[model samples]
Target: MQIQDLLKRTDKLPNVPDVVRELIQLLNDPNAKYSDIAARVSHDQTISLKVLRIVNSAYFGLARKISSIDEATVLLGMDRLKTLVIASGFASSVTKVDGIDLPEFWTESFRVAELSQWFAKRTESVDADEAFTIGIVHNIGRLLLHLTAPDVAHDIQTRVSNRQASRFKAEQDLLGFTSQDAGKALMDMWHFPKALGFAVQQHKRPFADGDPDPLACVLNLACYLNACIRTEREIDLVREGLPMAVIEAAGLSPSIVYELDDAMAVSDGLGHLIH
Candidate 1:
């Protein structure tokens, strides 16, 4: 299929609920007021219940229980709670990934989200909340492909595992586009921020256009480290850490990535917003 066709294939993608769409709109708004957001979320019972559940989940380890959106707002902060609401609200829409283990897929995605935010905080080059939200939703294209073309998607993943080659190449060979291409289309369909669309489109080649986007660079390095945590050997990780290009592009020290080898070795459910 051509890029135009992929961009227009809106009906083939997962159905994002209206609540999630509203949350996305709120998150993308720069001048959005906290009371407006709190009121919007309060009207949606599903989101309100899920938000309370996720915040109270042992993952956050809060000092006191949050019983209302107002309380959650004061405790988690508007920016942090906004991203959390997005994560929790948007998760149910993308759970049906073809040929991928659902639990393991979420586990890895959550790890990448945490690591992306962690890297962003350490670098201070981008908004950590945005990075976290981007990391979690970055691979919606893969889920789109799985839902749209199951057999072809499985074939590409098989080649990725067996040949240890880039999934991007495999996707291009078989489907005329990679997940990033699909991701861009999905981001556009969702009316997300332009930064998210740009990052998703070029995260793998963050420096392709001269100066790199700090957000994309962090996402690239975080995805790389997350993959290594899942698949590569520990000794190999210590001996050959993040490439110089990644460190320079993200303006982070090599030692930070190296030291993370032992620290972030396990996922341990650090990023699971939806249980």
Candidate 2:
């Protein structure tokens, strides 16, 4: 029931693509140029093609097609396009799990990621792309469980539904780890920058240490808002679930969150993911 037990279950982890690993390093480097990242992205034809497709597609709503990685870099900026590359490349690398619906999972991830970026930019609390990355990867542990421990994962989902148990509590009670634990272990395995890994670990209790990790807090709110959006709930329901520290950290009021309704919609963008 320890993290070690979960880690020992090899099927639970996503294979972080070489493309994603290199991009993470470049993003962490203060001196890394846009050209450098562009070059790295172009090294993987699948990712490069996927990014170009998304950029040129209606999702980005550009005036003209993005013909190459260089052009994509210029139009989308380094961070935003890089976030897309990472999301697409990582999605490409993960094999289909027996039970989880990857398309829905990815759609939700991207939705939350985009919302996180918008909110982060609003507050200037963290980099938009960093927030985006954290949001997309936050629930990765759920995938890990679906792959490596299907029965337990399904049972937890059932309990969360039938018994009104929360996902975290159900996971903790049945398997001795929450999705947060699995997320932390997965991100740690991928060797991302600390804040990205930390967000995965601390997002469920973003100010548990009495100080907010701005990105985690933003992601915390993003996940809540995503659920609200998916369920067609009112903004008040979302506000009720949000932590006060997260609201302060993101410089967001309930009114502002309410105002963000349109920007957070994902039905159009989910169509752009590579098949």
Candidate 3:
């Protein structure tokens, strides 16, 4: 089925919270005050609790507890606060899909989000916080498919698992579009910046054309490094496994991946948010 058809199943597709939708709009507004953002987040009790829980968790290494959205905004800065609120909102919104391990999925997603932020900051290629937000939501398409068409999604995943086809190829052959396409559609539906939708759509082939989105390049590299990190690949293997073209496209030196690898080793605590 087409993405629009899947999206039309509003009863199946999870809805992003209203507050998160509003916060996303604030991301593009330069004049949005931190106080205003904090107040907006406070509007959702569930999201606010999750956001504060994540901020005060060991992942952030905060010395003092943040009891309120206002305190979190003041302590974490607007970008950091925005990232937490967005992450919390998205995570809390989605329901469990059959055949997918929700905890593991979220763990990897958060890992990628952190790694993407690191790459963005290290290479100065994109807005680091925006990179983080994109990373968190990048896999929404996979979840959406499972939610809307479980049998087809499972078949496609099985094909990839059995080495019959790559995930992207299986998705395109079976669904007529890749998860990236669905993700882009979802981003557009949610009114995210067009650039973010482009990044989601082209993350797998960020350099497929003459011009590549820097955010896509950052996300693509982060996914590679996330795989390496998860598999406990040595730094040498990680370096050798990276696509040199992607490295160059992201304007990252070969050595930077080493530093990133080290950083990810300690970021396992981020799972605390989802756990």
Candidate 1, 211-251: lDDT as tens digits: 88888898887888887777755756544766668767776
Off by over 4 Å in 3: none
The local distance difference test score of each candidate is: 0.76, 0.77, 0.83
**Backbone atom clashes (below 3 Å) for every candidate:** 0, 0, 0
Deviation (Å) of 249 in candidate 1: 1.2
Query: 24-66 in candidate 3: lDDT tens per residue?
Result: 7777788999888788889889888888888877778899988
How much does candidate 1 score in TM-score?
0.87
Model 2 Cα displacement at 128 (Å)?
A: 1.2
| Residue 113 displacement in candidate 3 (angstroms) | 0.4
Better candidate by lDDT, 2 or 3: 3
lDDT of 1 at 42: 88
Candidate 1 positional error at 76, Å: 1.7
Q: Give residue 23's lDDT in candidate 1 (0 to 100).
A: 64
What does candidate 2's lDDT look like per residue over 34-145, in tens digits?
8878888898888888888888787679998769999988888887777888788767757688777888888788778877887887776687778877877888888878
RMSD of 1: 2.7
* Residue ranges of candidate 1 with Cα displaced over 4 Å: 3-11, 25-30, 235-239, 254-273
Model 2: lDDT to the true structure: 0.77
TM-score between candidate 2 and the true structure: 0.89
